[model samples]
Target: MSKKLRVAVIGCGAIAQRRHIPEYEVNENVELVAFADPVNERAQLYADKHNAKAYMDYEELLKEVEVDAVSVCTPNALHAPVAIAAAKAGAHVLVEKPMAVSTEEGTAMIEAARQNGVQLMVAHNQRYMPPHVKAKEILDSGRLGKVITFRTAFGHPGPEGWSVDGRNSWFFRKPEASMGAMGDLGVHKSDLIRHLLSDEVSEVGAFVGTIHKEGTDVDDNATCILRMRSGAIGTLTASWTYYKGGDNSTIIWCENGVLKIDTDPVDNVIVELTNGNVERYQVGAMATNEQQTHSGVVDAFVTHILEGTTPLVSGEEGLKSLQVILGAFESQATGKNVKLD
Candidate 1:
């Protein structure tokens, strides 16, 4: 058998514990080698569990350990610097969603990975969801005809309800998280819409506000209007006020029919044709904070590293999604439509 690739996880935060580390543990192509976090105890805990080395400083870990790849699960603000440093250290990077806090940061990280000849993938797991996969296949089959418009939403009570740090998590801090719902939740919908339509967002108009949640300088609710390159217009919303439960549903209106994804409790993907025909598919259940099954991110990242191929959610694709959210923020600030170049 081929030797397993050495993998290191930076940041023993909620995402690292729940998704990256767990997924990497199951991937046969990888061997978890090291764990790093600012909190030494957190890093040591995961390291002890996995029988790996632990370090409080990622820079020290990168310099000392010879890792083949690293997962950047730190807060949004640290995404760019840590990913760039990891690439420079000759390690492929699987960064969490939103890519970075800004377009400049995202671009810099991509350039660093390109310069280092290391693969860089974003953990945009929404595209890997079964319902989303089925939706993409149905749309590509021309059964939906030309997509006219769509609406997508990703909302939950708050990250505090899920994060290991609870109410005092970095997710609520503006400096560490940059933005709240838009950065944390909205970016997922933006990336998913782009993946489903295979088009870029050309323009955006948005309203972002702090309707709920206290002790934070970030927006808790955000709504945006997107104009796709294919001339399809849509609405995107992200909120932290969905106190009942998380709702990650999408509706697409096409010329021939409408496709609803993750909208029903029974059917994960539903397609209705103009000729009075309806198809319902029971794709796997949607992932939630309480019940997150294996997201294919770590496995795909390992596959690309082992095979020396590009990842599905490459850094460039991730940057596009990040730019859309940044454009929405600009739109919110200017109170006008912002165009993407």
Candidate 2:
């Protein structure tokens, strides 16, 4: 058997603990080797639990250990720098979503990976889900016949309610992050709509509001309209105020039929044909890393490194989705349609 790839994880936060580490542990092609976090205790804890070395300084970890790949699980602001650093250290990179705070950062990370001749993949795990796979196959089958409209949403009570610590998390602070719903929840739907439709969003018009969570500097709710480059139109809504849950659903209307997937990733999907035919598919919820997003992404990355396969979610793919989210924020600010260049 080929040797297991040595993998290092930067930023041992809730995401690393919940998804990355556990997924890496189970993958036959990977051997978890090192961990780093600014918080020394968290790093130490993860190191002890995973039997890997830990460092508070990522550079220190990179310098001391030889790793085949690294996961940049740091805050949004640190993603680009860490990814660049990991690339320089001769490690392939797997960065968490939203890519970075700005397009420039995203571009820089991609360049670093290219210049270093290493693979760089963003964690857009939604594309790997069975339901999404089924949906994509259906859409590509021309069963959707020039899909004219696409709508997708992913929302919940808020990250604070789900994070390791409530109210004091970095997610609520702007310096540590950017738009709230736009980054936290909107990015998922943005990636999904683009992947399902297989088109780039050319323009966006949006409205963002902070109707709840007093004292938070970020918008908790966001809605937007999109015009695809292929002349398809769509709408996206992301929110953190859905106290009753049941978010993360999508509806697509095409010339031939309509397809709807309920909020839960694992559930019954409904499809309606223009000919008055309807079908239902029962899908079990998939285990997507820690946040139920995409553990398959981790496995895919490992396979890519071990066997020279292409990444399931490349940096370019992440940038396209980021474009949609950032365009939405731009539209929200300017109160007009923002064109994608």
Candidate 3:
């Protein structure tokens, strides 16, 4: 058998600890060889658990560990710099969602990967969900006919109650990350909308505010109206103070019928026709838990590296999604629709 690919995970935070590291542990094709975190204890904890080297500084980890690739699971602001460093170090990169806080930073990551001749994949795991895969298939099959309009929504009960440390919740900090619900949850909806519609967003009109996050520098809920290049209309909502279980759902209105991409863990997708008929699609295989989803991404990453294939979610795709997030911010700031070229 070919040797397992050596992989390093940067940022041993909740995401890296709960998702990326365990995934690498379970995947037989990949080896978790090193771990890094600004916090020495956290890095040490991860390394001890996974039997890998640990470093407080990511640069030191990069230099000391002979990693085949690295997973950039750091803060929103650090993604581009870490990814660029990994690419320059001759390692492939798999960056977590939203790519970066700005389009310029995202572009820099992409350019660095291209210049370094390394594969750069973004962890837009929702795209790999069975419901999303089925939706993409239906869209491509022309069953939805010409896509006319789409509505997508995702929400949670806010991360303040979920993070390990309530005081250091990065989701509530704008400088460390960006907007609240928009970056954390909104980007996923935007990504799924783009994925299902097979189109680029042309313009954005948005409303973002810190209505529920009592003392945060970021928004807790936001909505964006999107105009697709293909002349399709769509609406996306991301929130943190939802009354019920977390929701990730999308409804696409087409010429023939309406297709629903409900990424809710229970009911994935549903389709309805003009004749009042309905059909449900339950797509499962990839695990729904964070760690399992990370496994799916890791498997894809190792496979692409070993087999000489392209990533399922390329850096360019991540950049597009980031643009939508940024555009929404701009729209919210100007109180006017932002246009995309």
Candidate 4:
């Protein structure tokens, strides 16, 4: 580990620019070695910025380049294949969230990493946010008692605002994105609720719809009723139609009080106990679609790779959270609650 850890980013898109590249650039131990994207210019753009090699075909990049880590920022469908290939090539992988379209794919990615003795980390950045980290600490302290329920949401106008390609972004395509807002936004909350509460969703009932966006076949809005293994029930909503401002908030009602996060326009975390005591903490703000901030994912992934340790969001954790979203789809199609196995 004397030399800086060599890193490469697959799929030089908006996320690579906003989250991956910039964060890696700031990390003192990482050396960005290469970049790859389907679009040659996109790959070259980031490559030029970092003085790294560029490739259009990621497979070629893998075959020719030797790197210690790779950030898989490709479309949802490609997450598994690229990660598996990278793992087999002896590179630890930090893949984007909603790890894969299905559990089978996610499992394969995990297994590939396992067989190759490489770490597989998922980019579930919400858990790394200042407010969320503070929320977890408060909840873990048992100052609020056991969390009984929560109403969490992650919504924005749509991918057109954040995606590099605007409306032509792969986020609008079913084949590329797998699920729309749920995959894009909700999975973060799904993983967050599980992280803060330390529970798994056992059942799900959802209403997934393609409302508003006339051209897209994928859902633009999703509301899921989740039943955690601990018997805590709550609602999780993901939407691409919150036009006024982005909503990235979570309100957890515990046995003794309620904990509000990212809700107050001014405060970071709020505590309203049953005894009429109100406290506010100024942890920090969440990064909106219009803002560029450090996600903390790249640094964590690099650290895990260097230390040979498990990440906060490992591939298995990613698969379980992904199952919750997949269950939502099943529930939406059948109009009945889907119990995850």
Best by lDDT: 1
RMSD versus native structure for model 3:
2.1
TM-score of 1: 0.99
lDDT of each: 0.93, 0.83, 0.83, 0.92
Candidate 2 at residue 281, lDDT? Answer: 75
RMSD in Å for model 2: 1.9
Candidate 3: segments with Cα more than 4 A from true spot: 263-267, 285-295
What digit string (tens of lDDT, one per residue) describes model 3 on residues 1-341?
47888899998777776777777788888878898888789888878877989898889888888888999988787888999999999999999877888888889998999999999999887787777788889889996689898888888788766555554777677788776788788998788788888799999999998886677878889988999999999889999888576677788999989887764455577778888888877776434322244446777887898887888789988889888989999998998999977
- The candidate, 2 or 4, that scores higher on lDDT is 4
Estimate the TM-score of every prediction: 0.99, 0.95, 0.94, 0.98
The window of 10 residues in a row where model 4 has the poorest summed lDDT is: 284-293
| Colliding pairs, model 1 | none
Candidates, ranked, TM-score: 1, 4, 2, 3
RMSD of each: 0.8, 1.9, 2.1, 0.9
Of models 1 and 3, which has the larger TM-score? 1
Model 2 regions more than 4 Å off: 263-267, 286-294
Cα lDDT over the full model 4: 0.92
Give per-residue CA lDDT, model 1, range 1-341, as digits (tens): 47889999999989999999889888878888999998899999988987999999999999999999999999999999999999999999999988999989999999999999999999999999899999999999987789999999999998988888999999999999999999889999999999999999999999998987988988999999999999999999999989996789999999999999998999999999999999999989878888898888888888888889999999999999999899999998999999996
lDDT of 2 by residue, 81-183 (tens): 9999999999999999888888998999889999999999998877877777777878888976988787888778887776665678777888887768788
Error of 4 at 93 (Å): 0.0
lDDT per residue (tens digit) for residues 1-341 in model 4: 57998999999888888899899999999999999998999999878888989999999999999998999999998999999999999999999988999988999999999999999999999999999999999999998987788999999999998899999999999889988999999899899999999999999999999999879998999999999999999999999999887799999999999999988888999999999999999987888878767888988888887787899899999998899999999999999999995
